[model samples]
Target: MNTTDALEAFALTWTGDLTYDVAPSLSCHEVDTLATLLRALGYTAAADAWITKHSRNDDEGDAHYVTPAAALREQLADASDRTPWVELREEEPDAFAAGHMVLHAGGRNRFAITEQCDRPSDDPDRT
Candidate 1:
């Protein structure tokens, strides 16, 4: 299939998120749609609802597997580099402050759901 077809297929299975206020002052927020993509790409565990005859285990993959498109991954990664989702600072100051920014710098997601962060090379000692 073409890139649009691949992205469309991937989008159809998007899981969105899960929300709960587990604490009085803090809420452990999580996004499950990304979770599904992560799982398929051999990252996170797929949701329990994915019980399929072919999947080795429900936690292993979704009801269907999606093969990522290299072109799409490249395009999304390029776009992310230009304007990172990692930079929602003012509008999402709390999220911006929670910096695990380095992780986004490098990863393999042939699918477009996740993109490798294109951070500039680091020189350890800044101070």
Candidate 2:
């Protein structure tokens, strides 16, 4: 799929903000969608790295397997240069202070989603 298509896919499955007050988090399914998009964009290595980094288990068994994509949700939203793999295009919303991010990697527009802060709020950091 092309960059636009990948972005659309990401948006469609986006979980948005799960916590109202705390930092936003993405669901496992949302993270997996991004991983799949990475592979589709020819970033198989990056995709694998992401999945491996996120996967975890309490009993070290498959029964309770989980991939918490929370930490990087902020990282991606902030578009930190700490990870050199993805480039981000941040679009501030026209009305509300809410924004969206489009991630580019492996010469493809692979991921896009409405940011966790995509809104006007009383929080000084958010506005």
Candidate 3:
């Protein structure tokens, strides 16, 4: 699929109900292709996060899983890089602030993005 098509497919898979599971089973090549497309579309942070979360290091001699949030944090914390997730911050403020970006995995090799709540969890009115 083309970059726009891939992005559209990714967005179409988004879910708002956090209680419901959202995982897209994709191959390693698919993951790499998707990340590359995202980077081409100016989603550098998301692309890097995807790569970091999915990359397997043979040198380590064992597979290690990194959470999407952790990967995103690492990318955003890099001082040498330009501002990351500018479009995401403007488009999805709650998710951006909560460190919940597109393409997150609840388990190894499965990934999806969910809509985040804007309200504080401590608020009794929030459901």
TM values, all candidates: 0.16, 0.28, 0.30
Per-residue error at 124 for model 1, in Å?
39
- lDDT of candidate 1? 0.34
Best by TM-score: 3
RMSD of 3: 15.9
Worst 10 residues of 2 by lDDT: 15-24
lDDT of each: 0.34, 0.50, 0.44
Give the clashing residue pairs of candidate 2, or none.
Answer: 98-118, 98-119, 99-118
lDDT of 2: 0.50
* TM-score, model 3 to reference: 0.30
Tens-place lDDT per residue, model 3, 15-71, is 122112211244456656766766666666566545554543212332334444444
lDDT per residue for candidate 2 within 1-127, as digits (tens), equals 9978876665443323322211113345655776687677666655554544444322235322443333345457445465588775664344224355666665544566754553466766552
lDDT, candidate 1, at 8: 56
- Candidate 1 lDDT, 19-120, residue by residue in tens: 112111221122334445546655332332231111222231443333233334433444555665432111223333322222233333211133334453
> Runs in model 3 with CA error above 4 Å?
1-26, 56-127
TM-score of 1: 0.16
Candidate 2 residue-pair clash tally? 3
